[model samples]
Target: MVTDLQERSDQINSSDQNKIIIKEISIESEDQNQKKIKESKRLFNEGSALNNQNKYQEAIVCLDKAISINNQYDFAWNNKDNQLLNIIIQDMHYIIRINTKKQFYVMTKLYLLILNMIPIGLIRSNKGILQYN
Candidate 1:
């Protein structure tokens, strides 16, 4: 696992190097700043170790950090996962049903809420649009 992390880290370094080259050639947007993948890899390796020792909560924290860095990481879900992510689906259902507005309203609000709470981007207002908040 550590070896894997190191290999991944090397890949990230290459990616970052590429980014640096891009920035040198063209103007980069704020959103274009690649995450500091170094720290994320360290966290991933630590979490993997914790998971092997059956420290689930600790592992989850580390995995969550890694996910925050790179949401596409399936490795974060690998420690002790069930095929069913029922809890997440249940939460989504409850969020929609609780505010039983129109279907579109419910779905929009559900996504907005998750975006607001999670590090995901918000879908709603800056100057109080009152559209979905």
Candidate 2:
């Protein structure tokens, strides 16, 4: 009967050991995820600074890394898109300035494109539906 009691004790100890292992695994996983999130935010802030300095391409690279680390990072996504838009605007302005009369058609096309991209609409429909166009 002492052997039977020993067997029961061994089983309980084994189950407790399994629980400790699972807890350790969970804690490690949480720590790794927190590290990744912190890294992602660091990269995002660096990217934003580069963007403000007009180092758009470099900023985009950093932002891409942040997004890769945290795909659901909305701030990174929006910042990247904004940087791309700024680059496009700068390029369009340069082209218009450099090719004024010689490429009036191209300049006009670019202007139209920019105009169409206006983000806000103030139109009010007859039914007061707040039309965006």
Q: Which prediction has the highest lDDT against the true structure?
A: 2
Deviation in Å, model 2, residue 88 alpha carbon = 1.1
Per-residue lDDT of model 2, residues 1-133, tens digit only: 9999999999999999999999999999999999989999999999999998999999999999998888867788778877887888788778778877646776677678667656664343434334577
Model 1 vs. true fold: TM: 0.36
RMSD of 2: 7.5
For model 1, the run of ten residues with the poorest summed lDDT: 121-130
Residue 32, model 1: Cα distance from true site in angstroms: 8.4
> RMSD to native for every prediction?
18.8, 7.5
Q: Tens digit of lDDT per residue, candidate 1, span 22-103?
A: 9876654434434446666778889878766756567778878876776555555443131122334455677667765665
Clashes, model 2: 0
| Clash count list over all predictions | 0, 0
Off by over 4 Å in 1: 1-22, 25-35, 80-133
